[model samples]
Target: MAMFVHLTSAANAPRIRRSGIRAVGHGQGGARGVYCFPVLPSYTHTHQWLRELARFGSRGGLVAVHMRLDDTQEVLVGRYSDRARGAQSIVSASEAVRRIAALEDPRGWEVFVPRAIRPREVHRVRTAPQVAGWRYLPDAHGVRPCTCDGCRVRGGYGSRRLRERLPHPLDGPPPPVKVLLARVEAGDPGDPVALREALHWFGMRRRGPLSRLSRLAHHPDPGVREALVWAVGRWSTPGVAELLDGLAGDPDPDVREAVEVVRDPE
Candidate 1:
């Protein structure tokens, strides 16, 4: 009765369940459930489907993925869309698998535990980042940290649409840019996870304001600062080199090193 959306190559869903992997895969995906839908997950309309799996008639929904390798991999399961940008397809399933695997190999993807849903829900769909409680961490060593790629392609084509020059990543009936910006501006300095997510949203924006980057450049946490550098590089903006040049003097060695690598990629 659940929908098992398999985003990666192969993982032997039965083995995953027999071992009692505990709702680790996205939407409990990859399992050859009573009902399963195999589709390559993307940041586009995929997010809407993830939330309303039951609406799609699956008892629950799951998107099993791995970060990069197709070897023996684990995937980003049920994980919710980005709080700020919703969900965009950026990081590949394998990319996420490798990142999580790094934290706790094989069971690395277990880090993202989604809300449990039953088969008979008649109304209301669900999404991730429940305002508070637990959160997903985007590792420092990630290529495109989050798996949402739709936004990475600049919402549609180019970075952003000219008519809709909004701060938030392109979303239907989008939230006010100010509100999205506030999430970053007012994020907890001590929580690198929160700050990095904010920086990520800004970088993902096609028409995002550049000031957001500078404002968070000297964030209290070095990890957040490092994230800021990554966001800049990821966004591929106009004066990226100039901006990174300024960050050369950043106090954190990691931040400076990131600038160097991003400035001249091999």
Candidate 2:
């Protein structure tokens, strides 16, 4: 058997003790599953989700519901954003533990069992530290934080303070695709940071003029070319293939690597 821990609100303790943790969706468009982490040898690593989970405003208190599952039980495992990016993979319970343990930094990794966990499988429900893990993201300290609405919750903990402390180029709602494209088309493309932000926003939103974006393949700045690769990958329209093929052999290794990561899975 493999040990795992599910962090939840202490308010649900009674029902969880009686009927077990229910399989339900969390977050917008989240998959229905019981999220947990493999109870590794390191106590801190096992309970790394405590602080981040508490940010959701749990009532009563927070607790860690330790549970056990057979090594053969299958589950979904990947980075925290893998599900949203359509990149999560399936593996056995033991394999999931081994895979995460092998990572140098498994802070954002998670496992999802698709069904309900019976009360029998729950080892114990114990009080957990309210502050044990990274909030917002793992190791976010020292990095320039994004203040975009999508990235920062309007009233989330310390969100306003962080935005005031670190203003980013991509800090507000992004301009429309045409507006961004116009900025790139200007003879003097100002602010490389803003330019890159525009391209990345295009990629994320999956909009804009595909033909015009394709022309950026030969942009002078490698960073622009890399951002172009991001935008181009989001487009599945005509002419995108030719642009990607050209970018696959970019002189800069980073641009080529971006092409690999952004390319649609086969």
Candidate 3:
């Protein structure tokens, strides 16, 4: 699922382009498509740009607007299988506008990126050197972090199963479990897929049987803490109660609620 911003009018291009790009939840169904544009890289720039994007969406003008979150759920890598690719280069916003507007099917997934949109790969090279930590992510295919929309959206540790019993007499989390935990524990906090799946593993007691992840209860992201709350019941040890006690004071209401609901579902 690549990001596609439909220029409402030719005039909106320059203003929208000033807002830098980042992917959050969005889709094209309700005009909620991702609207990342060419802009200077700075924290303040993103903060201001988001305001502009939302403002344009309100008036329903040529400026960047919102899209349905559901439509942009799946992020895919490489050329999309079903949708046709946009032109190699669209010289002017007018041409891009004409081409997309002239499309045989305006409701399709095709996107027209007008200029050199820097790839996400550039950030990884500069910020994160190769480390053993990345091995846990589901994308075993390659080393570099995949920027494909599909790859981005693929979360939850790949399995929903509660647990898989160990085969040998030795008592240690199998390598696979270790990797899953690594992915959940060390993964991008913004993406919580693996963290969710890892919680399920813990909920099944495979976590205790294999290993314990004490740090999970204190994960900085509230989403991870909530998942841990739901899984606390599965800790076959006395620590479950203590963990729940600690979580009762959690800052996020959602996390506290998960603890309460999971503790006493009746």
CA RMSD of all predictions: 17.1, 12.9, 18.2
Any runs in candidate 1 off by more than 4 Å, and if so which?
Answer: 1-147, 150-176, 187-191, 234-239
Better of 1 and 2 by lDDT: 2
What is candidate 2's local distance difference test score? 0.77
Worst 10 residues of 2 by lDDT: 24-33
Candidate 1, 148-238: lDDT as tens digits: 3332234433334432443334333344667657777674454668667666656555545666557667677888778778777745457
Q: How would the candidate models be sorted by lDDT, starting from the highest?
A: 2, 1, 3
lDDT of 3 by residue, 1-266 (tens): 22233223334334434553323222232222233322213223212233323322222333333221223233321112232342233234333334444444332223333222233311211111111111223234466433221232222342222112322222223346566666665744535667777675555442363225557676788888888876665455667778888888999988886776555331
- C-alpha lDDT score of every prediction, in listed order: 0.42, 0.77, 0.41
**Model 3, position 186: C-alpha lDDT score:** 78
Regions more than 4 Å wrong, model 2? 26-30, 148-266
Q: Which residue pairs come into collision in candidate 2?
A: none
Model 1: what TM-score? 0.35
**Stronger candidate by lDDT (1 vs 3):** 1
Superposed by TM-score, candidate 2 places the C-alpha of residue 201 at a distance from the truth, in angstroms, of 20
TM-scores for all candidates: the values are 0.35, 0.58, 0.31
